[model samples]
Target: MNAWLDDWDGNIARTKGVCWIAGWDGDAMGLNQAGPSIRCGSLGEWNPDERMTRLVLIGTDIDENRVSDTLDRCLVRADEEGTSWNPERGPFPRR
Candidate 1:
């Protein structure tokens, strides 16, 4: 699919819920800034914003679905399936 700008009130810094997952096998969705939640202080360092870098994990990976479900709980959406996601806009809009 092509890149889209859904105009989400200028939130470039993607928090947990605001991020989407794009992987090799048809990209999963709802993967927060920290992919698949890990234990506290376990997900090692990475070069955020600059590029996508993998963090060093000390423990077994958490269930990605659990993380996705958790994100769903926090997300505020008008859609029922929680499929509606808004991307950031470019160059700002005119009032």
Candidate 2:
């Protein structure tokens, strides 16, 4: 998780846009601009059984597909039967 956060921070620092992430504990929510500044916080209540995340990015030259692809890699995949969502092998690969 720390490694992923570090990498995400680095990416946001280099990106020429605004970015925000909201999720459960250990995951930070923030508004990152093109600079060494990020205003971060939580998204209120967190329900462990229903874990989810919402990320938003906006910019003039942002590649929508690239952003989607990158973010999609961070998601917790659904099971084959679509009856389960597991974060055990998420981007951070946590259980």
Candidate 3:
């Protein structure tokens, strides 16, 4: 699972021209930054105008459907946060 996810992360970063980072916290898997969920943090680790980072969690035993749903929700929440994310612009587009 880790190998596959690493590949996926690399692919996302390469293809999207954005940083993709994730980690396991012994419970759910967390995405520190991915796709359109990018934003600046308190430390100013990211510049949304240039790059964005955000955290979203997907629990253990995840499947494709779960990943899709989580990303959709992330996009929605990002939009609510005033980000103009075009869901249709990425590999996963809210489906």
List, in order, the clash count of every candidate structure: 1, 0, 3
Which of the numbered candidates is closest to the native, going by highest TM-score? 2
Ranking of predictions according to lDDT: 2, 3, 1
Best of the two (2, 3) by TM-score: 2
lDDT of each: 0.29, 0.42, 0.33
Estimate TM-scores for all models: 0.22, 0.40, 0.24
Root-mean-square deviation of Cα positions for candidate 1 versus the true structure, in angstroms: 14.1
Off-target runs (Cα >4 Å) in candidate 2 are 1-34, 46-52, 79-95
Task: Give the distance in Å from residue 72's predicted Cα in candidate 2 to where it truly belongs.
Answer: 0.3
What is the per-residue lDDT of model 2 for residues 4-52, given as tens digits with 9 covering 90 to 100?
A: 3445533343433222232234443433344444334444444555445
User: How much is 40 displaced in model 1, in angstroms?
Assistant: 15
Give candidate 1 regions above 4 Å deviation: 1-59, 79-95
Which of candidates 1 and 2 reaches a greater TM-score?
2
